[model samples]
Target: QQQVKQSPQSLIVQKGGISIINCAYENTAFDYFPWYQQFPGKGPALLIAIRPDVSEKKEGRFTISFNKSAKQFSLHIMDSQPGDSATYFCAASWNTGNQFYFGTGTSLTVIP
Candidate 1:
């Protein structure tokens, strides 16, 4: 079963706007949460990550909001640009072994 669940499936935003994607997980054992961004023909790469110890994390314009008690998390792209358009995925792992769970993914398009 998919331990992580994502919503909206897709998104469209104007230039300089904000893009948001949400994800939820049912596993309390998941200690690592990471968001990935993938461009066409390329493998997904880590964009941002957080541990349960952190409520939020940010890297440049990308921010990850984590709710430990609620078992949920979200990614927010501020001042989104056309170059920010890509496929985003949320994943959860125990930070050990090879066990990991990924969300369905959300396609983002930033219109010029």
Candidate 2:
């Protein structure tokens, strides 16, 4: 079973709009949270990540909000563009991690 639950199996966002995806994790032992972006026929690439020590993290137009107490995290895409259309996944792992537990991905479509 998956430890993380991701919502909005698919999303459509107007160009320049904000695209948001949410995720919730079950295991408190999961200290490392990472968001990945995958293009078709390619491997998922690390987009952003956060530790329990940090409340939030942002890189460029992407931001991650983590609520450690709530065991939840979310991804926000600002000024979404057509090129940004892709599948997004949320994952969790421990400090001594070997495997990453992935959430059901969200397919995003940025309309031009």
Query: How many backbone clashes can be found in candidate 1?
Result: 0
* Candidate 1 lDDT tens digits, 12-109: 99999989999999989899999999999999999999999999999999999999989999999999999999999999999677566899999999
Sliding window of 10 residues with minimal summed lDDT for model 1: 93-102
How well does model 2 score by local distance difference test? 0.95
TM-score of every candidate: 0.96, 0.97
Model 1 bad stretches (over 4 Å): none
lDDT of each structure? 0.94, 0.95
How many residue pairs clash in all the candidates, one count each?
A: 0, 0
